[model samples]
Target: MSDALGYASPQHYPAVVTDRWGRVETTLVNDGTAFGMILRGNRFEGKSVDGLALVGPPVGSNPPTLCDGDLCSCTIEWRMPIEVSLDGAGPSRVSLSAHLVLGDPTPNRGIDSVGVTLTLHLPTGVVATTTPQELIENALLDLQRLLPDGTRLLACISCAFSDYSPAGTAFIGSMACFRDRKDAYRAVSGKRDMYDIWSAMSGVVQETYHCPDFARRRPGSGYRG
Candidate 1:
């Protein structure tokens, strides 16, 4: 990009984008100064990006073999597409592809397990995205508006009957409903005194997901997540 714009020396730094697991996703490269470009001469290029091939990425540490008529036996491929929408805006599409390749019968060795390599593709310009906390809050407010005048969006996050687990949350949440045995399990959920009583019947719940067993949390309970 610098050569295209006639730059002798480049000073702008490139910012990398990554997934939650700290894996490389994409990068934002600046080629020139702001005055000569659109505030910043940012380029979103994927041609040279490693592990971008749909079949087999040569840049991978161990390039996977898809198929070899003489040396390979069976191969399987999997693909999944997900669309994410936030704040009632245009959704962004994310897709994942995987391949399971089995080598042909060998004279020297038996079939062994191989490692997995994943490559993610993101939109050049993200349309709309929000943090989990913000999304939860907004969803609750919207749900409350649709309910009756006196009703509120009561879920695990907003229920006094629910509390965090000993190991904290596992993505969605770690809170469990103790409305079944409020007295025995209300103080702390899923960890402590009610350890034995808490089972699948009163399991962990999503922070924003709605449920029938409803209970409002007290003000300043320090559990309003």
Candidate 2:
């Protein structure tokens, strides 16, 4: 089913009457339930917004376009009317209709990136935009630091870290995934160590290994299989 439109309900307010004697009186009438807040736009970083109209796809759907360097190509656009409350403040209301351009690219070859553009329709409208690449780089640094000191890089793009592990060395052509034997040979022929091989082609493999913690070695077992 399609999503419902925002502002589809009505809100009722109470009536107050003032007499000629300058006495103010109130007429109490039972009003229906409060209108549900319809946030029309997509939430970025968990901020609720209303009067947000999307001109393109909602968000995060990748368009098959190549990005230059680390900049992401524009993929989604938004059109919003004025009087939009961004954070429940009077100044938070939009002064003019505005357009927001959003871009997000899947990181197949390099660092992933995000982009945003805000264009106001006013004559002296302020344009505010940023990709926050520095913030992302800092966050990536934090993520890398979170890994264990002995962590070996693994590049399995198909499987999540929690779902799989390095089982054994996969000579590329042996796995049904490699189309060219030469490419496979170049990848795995010189891989003498497990860590080196895992780091180089982690995005191309799905080698699931058993990780049994704290197990007693069996008699004459040559390393844990």
Candidate 3:
């Protein structure tokens, strides 16, 4: 009933949680930075069936409300601790985890959980340049670990730069999606620009080179590209 947090639904981008009564709450706790969320309503009494709990402000007729039901609402607050670091100047992976506290009086439902991953766009100065061959070779190395056996490398169509940071040192580019992580790795290896030379070249090069290697190698053995 209360549109304070808006309509709740599982939409892409910021993770959203909605109740059966049309109350919506959106959370972006996956960022590499620390953040917190607090929702006060009369509908949140205990933990939801899905293990989600309602926090409370205590001592009031207008408790945290979940729906139209006459149940006392509670306050639910979540604090997410994020850690971020750049492996190179290209793309970086972020891992997130958090502790959720529901209700203040009894501290009923509290738990620790892992959130989603947040991809951060790094500056260009942080990334190193590589040739087409090198890019493909690196991609192949990453794909060998992500893809299952028998997966083959396919054509990698590069995309153009849609936006660039103000400093002009870095540019944001897009690429065609691969069938799987393995497919993505393979596609990244090949050089083929989609829009312009710069974007295509950068996208293909980055994608191919950024994947993590997961293959088992013998002592003194080098990567097979």
Candidate 4:
């Protein structure tokens, strides 16, 4: 089955994540038969540098998982230590920008990186007194501690809105790129939502493994005796 485009079976797509400097940070490929990729360590670090610091860590050893039958989905969660300094000596708010990329190979190899801006509204004392350069430097230094390895900047897209909305204002978040990876003709597709398809893919696998057929299969039991 295919969508209205008449393309038989969906295309095997790839997901890309770029940084503010227009570099390819992460690359996720979804082949029609299997899904896998070698994500750049720096790119992952860059993500943590972004506003993703709020998520913290997984509850247990088995970090959250997701799956989608044939497709592969997974989640990479982590946290960065931050110290808020409000000694009545800095700006009232701080803003930072990041990006994401979606890539594929079968259909074509395209990139999509959208800029994500994070604004930290400070308290009354420093909220209206800090300098843009100083605030940016502090945030970058904190992010560097969190990243360490550096990140990859992918293709450039448009500006996106954040999810953290406190006091009727939005905070920092990520813009995700979706790929089917089932068909080769249309691998790298575009999406404007923050649904985290990677996690969804992992869930699908968990469900499949729970089924009777998969449960009955023994590990390394392939022999024609």
Cα-based TM-score, every candidate = 0.31, 0.20, 0.20, 0.17
Q: Which stretches of candidate 2 lie over 4 Å from their true place?
A: 1-6, 9-73, 84-111, 121-225
Clashes of 1: 0
TM-score of 2: 0.20
lDDT tens readout by residue for model 3, 31-136: 1111223333322222121123344433344334333221222222222221223331232333222112222222343322211211212232221222211122
Question: Which number leads on lDDT?
Answer: 1
User: Which candidate model has the greater lDDT, 3 or 4?
Assistant: 3
Full candidate order by TM-score, most accurate first: 1, 2, 3, 4
Better structure of 1 and 3 per lDDT: 1
1 versus 4: better TM-score goes to = 1
What C-alpha lDDT does candidate 3 achieve relative to the native structure? 0.25
State the displacement of the C-alpha of residue 145, model 4, in Å, after optimal TM-score superposition: 18
Highest-TM-score candidate: 1
- Please give the CA lDDT of all the candidate structures: 0.36, 0.25, 0.25, 0.22
TM-score of 4: 0.17
